[model samples]
Target: MEDKRAAVTALPALFADLVRCETRLYNALNDRLREQHGLTTAQYEILRYLHDHPEARVADLATEFAAGVGAISKGIDRMENLGWVERRPNPTDRRSSLLALSHNGSDLFDAAQKTFTTRLTELLADLPALTTVARTLAHLRTTLEDRRIGLPAG
Candidate 1:
């Protein structure tokens, strides 16, 4: 009773702290990327994912990114305009298209990847415990997924 109440009382504080940290980190990273490469964080992430999974279809990519179709479509349109990706008609599924990283996209990724890696590395270099951070973030993601919170309703 009292013990459970005490534990519950502490949970909000812990959760708030974790959320604040994650939000700050995300904003900072996005800002840095925008400053350096003129890309929004979401755009960069999408490009990276497409670069890695060139065979992924548009719907699959939207799901993988936990983003809405409209959002992904907008991003893809922008990427296409930037010559970073191309949409090819999926032979198996004529209705939906396959999104693949273009040659220029690959080249851009190769050129920017090192700088992105270096920046991320620098950000994490002074972290107190890398493993703990990874584990905590993984736990948070799993919890969110399990609760069906913050994810697009399929």
Candidate 2:
């Protein structure tokens, strides 16, 4: 354990740890969300965003989630088919439609949010310095988002 700890103390090792941790967390969350709410993580995220940004368009969601518009649109189509979301013509942009959560979507999101938090807490239960790590990650995420490095140009 001491040797392993020493190995991960370096920057590259820490980055590898971060990547693996993210993958594990995402897979667990995706599985749980799918089993409980019929939502993949990506779909749940779209619903969550629509809940917050009631007037979002596909482009807006793609931008917010760092996904391509085509991918976002397909997810939206699935949710809309499930009666979890609806698209209304964007008055401002004829080519894009504004996305909103349906009544079912809002209810599902409310329930799923509880599951998400509970599962996340369970997953992090034994981890040390969770608060500090969360804060640091938030800062990193904000900085990366602002820089938009490695992202495709719009």
Candidate 3:
């Protein structure tokens, strides 16, 4: 027997609270990286991808990031300007360029990887309901991926 007016007020608050919670987590993680290594979340993502795929091209990175070529190019330009990445001509395509982590980039990525893994483990260790939370998130991710691929859940 809740009043519709009361329920309407609560809905917006609940949605806003969820958004704020997500933003807070992203900011906290970003601040940790900024403090420890002066790297942004986006930069870290690109570096990690390049490290894994070594010599990945701009087109591939663009597709993987789901960003436009200009956005990926801008990120690469910034990373390259900082000596964290390098781009060489693609052997098969004159118009495309391949990106790879430079020595400095690899060193930085290795350090950040350890730091992120350690901190995340520590964070999870202190949580009482982490197992349930992780399972729920995994299930949600799988559901979303399946939907994206046009597969019906049985």
Candidate 4:
């Protein structure tokens, strides 16, 4: 038991390292996006979502992003005011409306996407074993999301 504990001494700190990495990456991306396109990373992601999933509702975005509906609605309001996205009556529901990107939004997304990709690429260029890390993180994300803890040993 003593040897096992010693062997895994670094395991406890892995979560901290993961969080630090996420924070650094997010800040870097956000800064780059804002400087280059006058958009925050979150705003860019919302535009990206609208670009890909046209006619989606606020609830759909909230669920897709794991955010609150009110927060998503507020974000939509801001984007609508910016002329980046627009809402039309939801054909399927009276209480809800569908969202789509405006022409300007599409154009901005394309330009910002290039900056985002370039910055992300530059940041990740020094990282090793990208594929392995990505796969492991994906599995861990799914495991955590499914709440698969404290299960049967088998």
Highest TM-score scorer: 2
Please, what is the whole-model Cα lDDT of each candidate in the order they appear? 0.81, 0.88, 0.81, 0.88
Per-candidate TM equals 0.83, 0.87, 0.71, 0.85
Q: Compose the digit string of candidate 1's lDDT tens values, residues 11-60.
A: 99998988897687677778877787777667777778888888777677
Candidate 1 residue runs with Cα over 4 Å from true position = 1-4, 146-148
For each of the candidates, give the backbone clash count: 0, 0, 0, 0
Q: Write the per-residue lDDT of candidate 2 for residues 74-131, one digit (tens) a residue.
A: 9899889999999999898798888899999999999999998899889997789988
Scanning candidate 3 in windows of ten residues, the lowest lDDT window is 145-154
Tens-digit lDDT string for candidate 4 (1-110): 99889769978698789999989998999999999899989999999888889899998888667677888899999989999899999878999999999999999999
- In model 2, how large is the Cα lDDT of residue 98? 86
Cα RMSD (angstroms) for every candidate in the order listed = 2.3, 4.1, 6.1, 5.1
Better of 2 and 3 by lDDT: 2
Poorest 10 consecutive residues by lDDT, candidate 4: 145-154
Off by over 4 Å in 4: 1-12, 146-154
Cα lDDT of model 4 overall? 0.88
Quick one: RMSD of model 4?
5.1
